[model samples]
Target chain A: MSAERQGAASAAPDPRISMRGIVKRFGSVEALRGVDLDLHAGECLGLVGDNAAGKSTLTKILSGAYVPDGGEIRVNGRRVDFRNPADARVHRIEMVYQDLSLCDTIDVAGNLFLGREPMRGAFLDRRAMRDGARAMLDRLEIKIPRLDALVAQLSGGQRQAIAICRAAAFDPEVLIMDEPTSALAVAEVEAVLALINRVKASGVSVVLITHRLQDLFRVCDRIAVMYEGVKVAERRTAETDLQDLVSLIVGEKHVSKAAGAAAGPGGAA
Target chain B: MTAYTSRPAGSRLADMLATHAQLLSIAGFFLIMVVIFSVMSPVFLTTGNLLNVLRQAAPILIVAVAMTFVITTGGIDLSVGSTVALINALAAILIQFGIPWQAVVPALLLIGSAVGAAQGWFIAYQGIQPFIVTLAGLSALRGIALLMTEGFSVPIPGGIGFVQIGRGWFAGVPAPAWIAVVAAVAGFLALTGMRFGRYVTAIGANQEAARRAGIPTRRILLSVYVLTGLASAVAGIVIAARLGSGSSNAAVGLELDVIAAVVLGGTSLMGGRGSILGTILGALTIAVIGNGLILAHVSPFFTQIVAGAIILLAVWLNARVFSRLAAGTRRRT
Candidate 1:
């Protein structure tokens, strides 16, 4: 997964969530090999890697979007297992994928709850849902005129905000976002970065997976890099340079020794 | 900004016009025909003729209601026509074997639902293309109907229970017309008020998203198909009652008419955007067009050609109106 997920490995730094020895395979391709990860309270962990570097696979496992082949997961130092996204939701874990997973034809309220729509009698309680959706949007400072306006009518940034609002409305303890701003315009990307900061300030731990190094340096408190299926290095934003991170991600053996030696002190990446 | 963001006055008028465009256009067409027919013939606008039109529209409306569901799911059941034929054949065979009409009603309904479920399972679970499965069904079910009836019509016996279902009436309205009203109301309720309706729309909008959202996509798909079958069976019974007989050839080529009504009513063939109100309007439009054509003394062959052309035109217009509505705004960055 992302290097930011790896931290103070052997010392056990009071992690809110941790995964140990996670192994996953898709046919003959080993996507993850004995991976370890941890997330602390209210910390934004920025995970970076090249294409097919297992960043997505790890996020999927943590969010209960996929089942890991072998691993034990711990929440607040207590062991737990998740069989589905709903199961993870019980533990206050939610994921907002890059696609946003919002139904384009439905309005914000409908997309917010989706399959979990609130109903009164035989019909959907549109007023109640709309009110709740509006409240969530207001808190996020994203204004759309009508709760009934379809997502297809919204801008890319606005849709991303709605998605984060949805995950936040559910009151998840940990929120994972996959490449939240990869396809956005410059302004839209800035809006999403601001939303991420707002989400972190609200005391919800955020795991951001992205390939954009600039975004990592901009918003991430801790940076993690993954090479192939293994996390190569993890460093605090203050301690690591972009070139060293790039060297680890590209699997250059010349700098691997120095990078590995520094990361090993804290058993990170 | 509000004024600019809002629909134009002309577009607002257009929106209202477009909302009931199918009905308005169909009525306009009917009025022109009525004016011509009244000029040419004395008995063109008689009550008897109007009632006759109602009777003709009954079976088509029933079949079209089922088509509404199929089309709403971004799928079509080419087998509905065949299912109607099969139902008719089965009803006749059972009646001939001394089975009570009450029992036969349930049997036909069950058979219809089962056939629909089979098609739906293939579409939803097996990932088979709807066109192929229903097209295969169109052939298979008709063959079954032919096999059972041996390609012959079966005469209705006297004093059959629920024969009144086809021929009976409440107050002054025909029983079939009342049944059509009830079916339409039920369909409207199911589409707008129930959980099933929501799931159907979700599946139509994006099956993958709906599935990931934990919708019972497979089950709902099965139900939609089975519902269509049930509708077909109901139409079959009404047809059999109206004719006082059943034949393997009953409801032949009816699928095209039902689909035409659905598309004309503004139900997107692409799914995720259909309404019972629209379907009702669409079905009425088709009935009016067909009735008006005959009243105007048009040749039956020309009527068929004109009807097909009108359906295509209505759908094309519906697409333009909707796309305009969907593309109403541009961001002001």
Candidate 2:
């Protein structure tokens, strides 16, 4: 654990969102143990950890997909309890899940405005959805060839782009993304990374969870490393390099320079 | 960019054809059958015979329209036939017992909706397999109808206005056919143009995804079965009115005919894909086969044989050939 973590967070005095002592358990398996996280508005915080490190569980709790056994979340310093995803959504918190959570048979515009569709009287407003989806994609600088085509017909990067754009469309105060680029080709990954930065520029606090160590350097202002079910360390991206994050993620004692080099080079592997 | 993006890199015409290839395949089959029947029986294409065909096809079309909703959600209501029979027998017995025909219609429609709601509750809320739940209904509903009538056909008086729903004609078309048209148009609107249709497609395409997106998946799923139940009631009423009697034996195996029409029209059992237009065409095709075969001087038994064969062949080709083609298109795109 680094002593600098506390002050090394964003220079912003008031964090837009904060979670403290967020403990969750799946029966006897404790998935999250007293985790604390913070996000400043208009900045991306990267949550990095290995499998079963409870990164997903922690994010799911924040997104109201799961309830924490013990914890409190604050938005603008106001305490909030979210019983469901809808509750979290009311607070302008949104998440793009790891599975993508997209219907392959639906069109791009349909998937983008899924839960809250544009309706004119009794039917869907197709022209509105089409024009709106185009503007949404353009705002994020992602290009999807056809808005009417089924999502199954899109490239991996384009699908990921749609998911990100969908979450961003929530006009969220805090946006959480889980491995948004884990399934993309190289070019596509860059496109998504660029999307995240653009989204961050719009004053939305972003939580990004990814295993790709170098990606943290590109878009993240700060990196939080979790070991097992606990947050072992947090670092300002400028102060820490790949070696320190690699060591911290695997439990600082066993991280060798050789091991860090192998997992280095900023590729997903 | 607009020109390039408006049309994908693939040939737009080819894409359109490929996208609706299932619909076109069924349409082509329907047209060929019509031509063959017209050639064999000059009466097949005549106005009177066509009107008769529409009248006969009406009940099946009404129920199949609702079944489209059920199938689109990746479910089967095997009890639809029994539902029709139960309503048919129950309506007749009520009329015989001195209840006004007017009072019985809406009451039976409610009963039909209740039957569907029960099955849907079990499937959506209790986590029961839809097949098992509806299969139980298939057995139990028909049995209840048999008990109500004691295995005899109940006579419905020929003079009631209720009979108009089956035998009367308006604008030179049978009343039943008009009712069927309303059901089909409403169904087409719900499946193609409404938010209900979009959510139905999303739920079928990926239920968990739909749920996470804040769609009320369970409610949508349950409501689909209810639609089937309500449609089945209308069909039963139409059938009883036409025959002037009702029996527990009515519409026996009718579920197969409706399902065959739906599948033949290219609604995939896999649940995500549905086509109401394709369903109307498919039902009409089946009606023609039955009506045309008799006119062609073929044995009536062969009509059943052909309908059953067409069901098996359509499903086989879809599973083996069409799915492969769809996958190929998806891969290329």
Candidate 3:
């Protein structure tokens, strides 16, 4: 991103993506109510909350997996309506689902280019898929045994890498990753964190949803905390610590802490 | 760093074997069946008997090839036999009405595809179980055929060149076998190389994932059934032409044989894995068992019993012994 885009001191720049009054309901349960968010280019915004705090719902609406019951999403200053994930993809929005959304029977290269495979006349462009998969893995700094390996035989982290590689390879402008590191081992988490940073450096706006509070400080430029179905607080990562974030997430006396600097005990960043 | 650090990678050969353990086991078993049958019956090794076997296996091979696509998507079409009977009777009735053979063939194929499409819509779009939908098809379709033909065999006039489809030869190979070979090759190309085949496998593997990836999964699922229907029509035409008559009772247990052939070839009933080559071997294996048994003087009724036993044995070995063998070989290497 340009230098002006990174400065948040004054003269706020236009957000890469903006959402206003997002609301979603599953019958009697209100999943999200009147939630608004702004994401800038080349930044990772951490979304943290309890289970059903509307984090995943908000992200799902953003990724076009679910249409908000009422909301306006503006991307690059233009309002767009998405009816499905395919529509979101047209505007370069992508999400790595928590389930990983991968075909275990297909090879790595095939999974990377599932619906949009490169075809040569009547057949798949196998050579292109192989070389393209190699290039994407190289760019993301992810390694696996072979491009032709079936996903079922790969380790969990490798499978996660494949899922991440698929979303990142598509040059998405707004990438949402829901708990990418939830099931990974420790070393694998480090690798995924490194990969997230790599993706962010390429000037893509990223939304990361995770319960690992410690991970927020390491990768997020700003943290957004949710309580119930409402976004209760937003904090610049430099100005907040784990205690404050925890308090914000749990909605515990948020008003008193609101006035303080919230520079409590340092977190495990 | 590599994404996974748990273990060293195995040799490519070992990996390949493990990946294709089912195919390898079925292939080896097929070869073993051929050898045993040849030894058991002196006539089995001859060119004439093998061609006769090919002719007998042609209908099963053609339908089994299509069933491989259906099974690969984790769906079963139990109505294939009924489909054939319906198409067979309908063609005879249409021919008896003095229609051209050329027009009737294409017309029957379209009807077959329509029948399959109807079933597919319920299973794919309506979200019904394939087993239930096709089981209903099995009963309803044959009932229609029986009502149309009134439980009687309808005969076609001789020497209209239609019977050539079932009995005629080109380059000394049986015409039905040639048509089967064509179907197999086309199905093979579509399943292994084309985007259609990839999407079919993907749908079977993880349907939600495939859908989220933007694959037209329901359309693909629907199309596989259409393939089975079209293949059944071809089988029906071949049968009607060969016998000079159409019977509702024709191919009574054919669904069992086709399903047996597909499953025996190692296509999973649970979906996501398929092999056209395997289905060909599997159908041929079943045909040889039937032909070889009769030549060995076993009662005709025993063929069903023996074929059932073999299917059970082959699948058991593929899942248990051969899979372990594949893993063990990998570890040893």
Write model 2 residue lDDT over B1-333, tens digit each, in one string: 111122246666666766787787778778888999999998899999999999999989999999988898888889999999999999899999999999999999999999999999999899798899999999999999999999999999998898898999999999999999999999999998998988888888888878777788889999999999999999999999999999999999889889889988888787877899989998998888888888998887687888678667766765567646644554531
lDDT per prediction?
0.76, 0.86, 0.87
Error of 2 at A248 (Å): 1.9
Model 1: lDDT equals: 0.76
Instruction: Give the 10-residue window scoring lowest on summed lDDT in candidate 1 chain B.
Output: B1-10
Instruction: Report model 2's chain A TM-score.
Output: 0.92
| Candidate 2 per-residue C-alpha lDDT over A1-269 given as tens digits, one digit per residue, 9 for 90 to 100 | 32443432356655778889999999998999899887778878999987899999999888888989998998888899987777788888999999998988788999998988999999999999999999988877777877988888787767888888899986898899999988877777777787788778878788999988888899998889898899988898988988778877777567674465647455342
True contacts kept of each: 0.23, 0.45, 0.58
Which tens-of-lDDT digit does each residue in A155-237 have in candidate 3? 88888889988999999998999999888888889988887888888888889998888888888898888888888888889
lDDT tens digits by residue: candidate 1, A139-221: 76666666766666566767777777787777778989888876666766676787778878777788998766667777777
Best by lDDT: 3
Q: In candidate 3, what are the lDDT values of residues B126-194, reduced to their tens digit?
A: 999999999999999999999999999999988899989898989989999999999999989998899
Q: Residue A111: error of model 3 in Å?
A: 1.0
Poorly placed runs, candidate 2 (over 4 Å) = A1-14, A265-269, B1-8, B315-333
Best by DockQ: 3
Spell out the clash pairs found in candidate 3.
Answer: none
Candidate 1 ranges beyond 4 A from true positions: A1-16, A21-29, A67-84, A253-269, B1-47, B320-333
